[model samples]
Target: TPIKRAWIWHYQRDDRKIFIKIGNILNLNPSVVSRNFNKLERQGSDPDFYAKTSISERPRLITPHAE
Candidate 1:
């Protein structure tokens, strides 16, 4: 659930507001990545696209490299 967790973690961050390119999270084709990002955009809970959590409410989804 890295993708989902990433969305939550990204949502929580307050200092840096950079868009988490789907390419960086998923290993799918560009089309799939774009599609997923777009899908989130269409939803009200679009974490990767719009970041849906406040700093106090964000969950931390650590990247693999860190572990």
Candidate 2:
């Protein structure tokens, strides 16, 4: 459920780029990702949900350079 919780946290934060990246990595549409996150949120009853660890900072994407 940690992954699900993390997705919910990201969705709640309104991080559009993160959702796009998630969709790209998962081979899904960004809207599909958003819809799934919404479904997860509706399934959960926790009103005060927050990530166990602090993640206020945006995630950085690191790509390796080809030699």
The model with the greatest TM-score is 2
**TM-score (C-alpha, index-matched) for candidate 1:** 0.32
Tell me the whole-model lDDT of each prediction, alpha carbons only: 0.37, 0.45
Least well predicted 10-residue stretch by lDDT in candidate 1: 50-59
Over 4 Å off in model 2, which ranges? 1-4, 7-12, 42-67
Q: How many backbone clashes does candidate 1 have?
A: 0
Identify the runs in model 1 with alpha carbons over 4 angstroms from their true place.
Answer: 4-20, 46-67
Q: Model 1 Cα displacement at 27 (Å)?
A: 1.0
* Candidate that scores best on lDDT: 2
Listing every candidate in turn, what is its Cα RMSD in Å to the true structure after a full C-alpha superposition?
12.1, 12.8
